[model samples]
Target: MYRFRPRVLVDVSNIDMSTSMLGYPISAPIMIAPTAMHKLAHPKGEIATAKAAAACNTIMIVSFMSTCTIEEVASSCNAVRFLQIYVYKRRDVTAQIVKRAEKAGFKAIVLTVDVPRLGRREADIKNKMISPQLKNFEGLVSTEVRPNEGSGVEAFASSAFDASLSWKDIEWLRSITKLPILVKGLLTREDALKAVEAGVDGIVVSNHGARQLDYSPATITVLEEVVHAVKGRIPVLLDGGVRRGTDVFKALALGAQAVLIGRPIVYGLAAKGEDGVKKVIDMLKNEFEITMALSGCPTIDDVTRNHVRTENERIKSML
Candidate 1:
């Protein structure tokens, strides 16, 4: 017989995880990251996730490559929606998406700028995984619209990214939508400042979930530099490896106005459905509030530099 040691309780006393994005107040600092196929995860896909976000009073960014069309998802969601757009071979095809998103009442257009070409996905490649062809584009293309010939999702993605697009294209995107514009895939302080100078409304400090560049720095690593570079000229948001409440707390402490969630939400969607997605969002909010409280943060402001010691410790260890 052995004596049991008493467990030490962690203190999470006063926490405030409430935050906002693009002038919309959200219950927490989390947004669903846009992934291409929702149908593969669940039958309802974007529609289910949108409903889930609405139920939790959170925001969600719908993908351009979503299984359902913009109107379909927008009709089901009470949550604020942002459209994530990628460049297509033709300007008209890209413009059509923006117009449709605007007509469907999306509040902003997030132009993803890093993928001029699709990066190889080994898991998808190995399994010979094929994304289901979108019903929406069935009659829109030519007589022979090839779907699975290239590789997998990567091949499909390669067909969409426009290498010809430049800063001029960004200006054109701004001209097309009355909604605010946010440039995603910005990884450097210089590019962040350039976006501000380009007259965009916000910058999302992302690396396309580390799917694009294999050796790229994590979104959290360069967040401070981007935030400080922007100097409050525009709101800065982050995404990638942010699954915990402490992750959200750390982001705010590092100066991100809010954070975006990607793969975890997809995982939840895969496991359950709309309900699973909602549960994931709620779990994040609850954890964020708890982390804030335990860290002695009563409000968003209370999660300051002093509250994040691990980051500092890591930096010191690097030196």
Candidate 2:
């Protein structure tokens, strides 16, 4: 679906894919994206995912709805962790989570700016999917109760999540914690520029995996626009549909500092728990390394926008 401009006869005998996020060094630029209810995927849940991140030497944005507690995941391993959160109607609860993440040694707070309300997922509607008992909110919010009618997840999120969340609320989020704030879910350059203006540390170009709205542009398609807007002011990351090393390569060529993987992580966890997750990460890392070598890139910085050519560009060039 995409073409890479590989330069031959350039020595890439020792390719390096190592990079850092918010000053935290990682073995590779690949990170584990937050997906709710990892427990449903594996018995170990976020703990297992955290361990995989440790083994792979990368970051994992633990979901706010993780089955395992923050302290439990933190003590499980020395993996670099960040917490992904949605603003709750109860601002106190959101503030409490920020405090807990900091206390538990999380390196950053990834504020997912989308999902003001749950999207209408048809599969969930058909299955009446019951979300796992959210352990983190056990005492803080009632999770034992499940709606007998429709999707319990939709009901719970509607009642708990702050639908009124807006760009101005970034200031309120900043007031709560000192951790670096990376706003996720920007699909436009305007919003990316606004995020930079708001003083957020980084931006993640995403559309909540395109489940939030119909006909939304893919995150990768809009990555260059967002990156062009930011103009290297901060790191730009992408997460969604990244299944291989080439996907990571294409993203980097488009200006993504790194990419976070979502479904692949859960797939691995569902298959073999911690080891499965590691296999997924290792596969991507190895693939990315090979891709870099073939492309004459010896390091992360060597990956540039010119390295890739999208189909649209190809057609235009022919014309």
Candidate 3:
């Protein structure tokens, strides 16, 4: 949906893709987005993904529904990790997991605000897709309702998730943990502003991978709006539909602090192991570096809004 405005002869000899999020320096602006049931993708699950993130010198947001227990993933590697969560119906259930995450050395909490209820996935409905029991809530809560239904995700969310969750709960979460807080699943400038007003440390502009609400605006298309709304008060990140090196550059040009990868790395994990995951990251990093060199952006800060042109801008030029 966007094109680059490359600058020629910009001394492309050295390019650096490194950037930091909430004061932690990472090797690049690419972070691993939370995707659940890594074991279903590979036997190693989140453990392998954690190790891979450490190897890549980036962060991985562990899914609230991860198959690997928080403690297991925490002990598996020294990668900087953030825990993504959904507020459960049982208040203490969510509180206890957040406490465990903090005690286990997690750096931040990414509260997923989009899925108070599960979305309509026709494929899941057709094939009877079942959500694996979450290892994080093993003793605190259960997802073992009737067991045979493919709509287990629906069953679990209805029973465990608090659809009543709202902005006021941000204060409730902050009361329990000293870690920085980031609210994910916000797609509009309005909610983006609310996240900042709610005292969130960062905001992730996402549409739940376009799986939560169909025909929702693509995350990339709406990224600039959220970024503009935040007005640099907090770091704004984007996830969904990010599949290429150019995609990363496009997000940076539009004002994203970073871009998170979801499916590609998981595909890597399912195909090989940790090495496969690393390979996917390496390829993206390499391609992004080339994009930087070609586009006259030798550093992350060098990428600016002027470096890209949206279709609307192109049409406006004709006028």
Candidate 3 Cα misplacement greater than 4 A, ranges: 147-150
Residue 151, model 2: Cα distance from true site in angstroms: 0.7
**How big is the positional error of residue 213 in model 2, measured in Å on the Cα after superposition?**
1.0
Per-residue lDDT of 1-319 in model 1, one digit per residue for the tens?
Answer: 1111111253445455667888898888888877877898999989999999888878889987788988999899678999898878877777877898889899899989888887777776777667676754555532122445445667666665687877767788877778899989999999998899899999999999887889999988899899999999999999888988778878888889888898989998999999899888888888888766666667786666655655447568589
RMSD, every candidate, angstroms? 5.3, 1.3, 1.2
Candidate 3 lDDT, 224-260, residue by residue in tens: 9999999999999999998889999999999999999
Model 3 gets an lDDT of 0.92
Scored by CA lDDT, what does every candidate get?
Answer: 0.81, 0.91, 0.92
Q: List the residue pairs that clash in candidate 2.
A: none
Candidate rank order under TM-score: 3, 2, 1
**TM-score for all predictions?**
0.89, 0.97, 0.97
Residue 202, model 3, lDDT: 97
Please say which candidate is ahead in lDDT: 2 or 3.
3
TM-score of predicted structure 1: 0.89
List the lowest-lDDT window of 10 residues for candidate 2. 137-146
Over 4 Å off, model 2: 315-319
lDDT of 2 by residue, 111-158 (tens): 998888989888876787777778777768865447777777888888
Displacement of residue 64 (Cα, Å) in model 1 is 0.5
